[model samples]
Target chain A: EPEVTQTPSHQVTQMGQEVILRCVPISNHLYFYWYRQILGQKVEFLVSFYNNEISEKSEIFDDQFSVERPDGSNFTLKIRSTKLEDSAMYFCASSRRTGSPLHFGNGTRLTVT
Target chain B: AQTVTQSQPEMSVQEAETVTLSCTYDTSESDYYLFWYKQPPSRQMILVIRQEAYKQQNATENRFSVNFQKAAKSFSLKISDSQLGDAAMYFCALSTGANSKLTFGKGITLSVRP
Candidate 1:
């Protein structure tokens, strides 16, 4: 079974530094999403992309956050300036289409120091 | 806005026994989907089961089953013949039609004793 893959399972960066989280969604999937889980908190939606544009986003996805499908295969989330609160497990997910169950990646643990 | 709630923070069950994790959700949309995801110590999120709001029958997959009460807005996961491997953090999530962005609950940690 094809699954979503994320690189740099663990990332540690300075508070003011820029960081990019990479994800390779399932080859055949059309919808891509990013979610984050702060320790002891519920998983929160960050953004969703389809047809090469952002479809929906949450408040947590602010000016510092941006997502792009740089190529046909890789989806990347870039944070311009990291903050302590940005530390969490970031998950990448993909679905065949809307209403389909999303398949998630193992997640990238981002630690903002 | 949709919200999923997992009231029990943790639960314990002996091997071969049964355990149920409760979840309730509030959603104004009549058309939506519910899902249970399991995260073991490795922290990999695994899909356990899914329930469609329009379906009257509950969803089941082998030892995993759901008691879905649409009227009560409740969706609970029942694990039968539990094994130590079943120990994990289970999350209840919801997504509305045409919008696959999932809204998840805090999650419940299940511990299966041998």
Candidate 2:
């Protein structure tokens, strides 16, 4: 089965530096999303994209955060200035349509120093 | 706001025994979906089962089943004949039709004894 794949399973970035987390959502899936889980915490939604634009976003998705499809397959989340609090495991997910269950990637562990 | 709650932080069951993990959610929207996701030590999130709010019958997949009480806003997962592979952090999540973003509860760690 096709699965969402994320690059650089582990990323370590200096504070105040820009970092882009890349993901290749499952082919043929229409909806894409980004979620993050801090250690020992619940997973939190960051953003959701559809039709090449953001459909919805959480308060955690601030001005410093941005998402782009960039291409037909690549969905990337860019943090302009990383903060130490940004450290977490980021998961990329995709679904065939609205109301469909999302399939998640193996997640990228980001550590901001 | 939609919130999912997993009261139990951890649970353990002997191999071949049964285990149930409890989850409760508060949502104003009538149309929503509940899901169970398992994250093993590898930390890969895997979908275990899903229950649609509109469905009266509980959702079941092989040894995994859900006891969904829409009125009580409760959804629980039951793993029958548990195996070592069932050891993982199980998360209960909720998503509404208006918003597809999932709100997950603090996951419960499940351990299986041989």
Candidate 3:
């Protein structure tokens, strides 16, 4: 089956540095999302995008966080400044439309020291 | 706001046996979808099964089935004839009636023994 794909399976960065996690969602999917899972914590939603604009976002998606679908095929989440708390497994998910089941990528493990 | 709870942090079952993971949620919306996902050592999130709140009949997919009590706000996953491959962390997730931004539970680690 076709699946979502993420780049840089693992990312290691220092505090204050920036990082961009990339994802290539299923070719036919229209809705995209970014979620994070702190070690030993539940996955939390970060933001959702459709039609190149953000539709919904969680409180955790603050000023330092931004998402861009710079191209037709790539969805990227950029963290302007990293903190130790920002270290987690970032997941990219996509669905055909609202109310549909999301298909997730293996995830990008971001580690900030 | 909606919250998902997985009370059992860990569970164990012998190979070829059965095990059930429990989940509960708090949501005022009458329409929603519930899902069970498995995360293994690779940390890949795999969809196990899903249930629509409006459906009255429990859903079964091969060895995986769900006991969904809509009124009680309870949804449980039962894995029958468990195999060692079933040992992984299972998460329960909920999405709004019309959206797919999933709210997930803390997760339950299942261990299948020989």
Write out the backbone clash pairs for model 2.
none
lDDT of every predicted structure (CA atoms) = 0.94, 0.93, 0.94
For model 1, the stretches where C-alpha displacement exceeds 4 angstroms are none
Candidate 1 lDDT tens digits, A1-113: 89999998999999999999999999999999999999777788999999999999999999999999998999999999999999999999999976688899999999999
lDDT of 3 by residue, A56-76 (tens): 999999999999999899999
TM-score of chain B of each: 0.98, 0.98, 0.97
Give model 3's DockQ, 2 decimals. 0.77
Off by over 4 Å in 3: none
Give the CA lDDT, 0 to 100, for residue B52 in model 2.
87
Order the numbered candidates by DockQ, best leading.
Answer: 1, 3, 2
- Model 2, A1-113: lDDT tens digits are 89999998999999999999999998998889999999878899999998999999989999999999997989999999999999999999998876778899999999999
Native-contact recovery for every candidate?
0.71, 0.67, 0.76
Give the range of the ten consecutive residues with the poorest summed lDDT in model 2 chain B.
B94-103
lDDT of 2 by residue, B35-95 (tens): 9999998889999998889999999999999999999999999999999999999999998
